[model samples]
Target: MTVRERLMYIAKNRYARRIPLTSRLKAVLRAYLHERGVIDNDNLFISVENKILGARSIQDRLRQYGNLTGVNNEVTVSPNAFRRTFCRLKVEAGTNIFVSQRLTGHQSLEILRRYVEIYGKDLEEAIEKGFEGL
Candidate 1:
């Protein structure tokens, strides 16, 4: 599916009372097994009505897809990476550190401090330019 369509599906399926997309994605993933008639389901997006896909199952399928696509990049993808990306995007959007810290569920300022350290130098340069009027 197209990127926009996929995003819309995610939005719709997010927090849905039934059939969350994670399971649906797994259903698509289990397609090969199903095609071999090893599995009975005709639809890939299984009903979250039954249960959410197990975390380990999701990870294993991701690894399988990663292998199938020849995606041998040294970096590993995990759920935490998505959180980090979201945090960085929030910082880039100029959200305050305290607010970002809360959004990220960080119990200590140190987590926010790391993001500040990562982006702080650039912020300092930007800050330096604002004193001409003073």
Candidate 2:
């Protein structure tokens, strides 16, 4: 569940990031890799033509899958949406912002803050907790 590989973005920027995965996610990825069998390539995901999938292709495939599963109907599902959701979930789970930033490879807290949406309940809870120590 450790990400040690470099990820290349569409802008040709490459970055090596380490991300921790849940046990369930790790198991699912392992099963997927096992089912995929051995390939003579370093890419984790390949197209039906046995070629590396570019960022655009991956985004398109995700969008298509979301549409097929009727997820797009519920919300505009995209890769960015997944990123934002991940950030929000981490914050909601009370994970440290700095840890989330590292996991997400965000360069600054300002950029990471954009991905987090704080709810009214979260603010109310924070206020109560703040007063409890006063």
lDDT of 2 by residue, 4-85 (tens): 4323333324665445566776688789899998888888889877899888998899899999999999987777899899
lDDT of 1 by residue, 7-83 (tens): 22222224322222365765675684555553455443343453456557666777777677766375455555556
Off by over 4 Å in 2: 1-12, 119-134
Taking all chains together, each candidate's TM-score versus the true structure is 0.43, 0.75
How far does residue 99 in candidate 2 sit from its true spot (Å)?
Answer: 0.6
lDDT of each: 0.60, 0.81
- Candidate 2, position 132, lDDT: 98
Q: Which 10 successive residues of model 2 have the least lDDT summed? A: 4-13
- Highest-lDDT candidate: 2
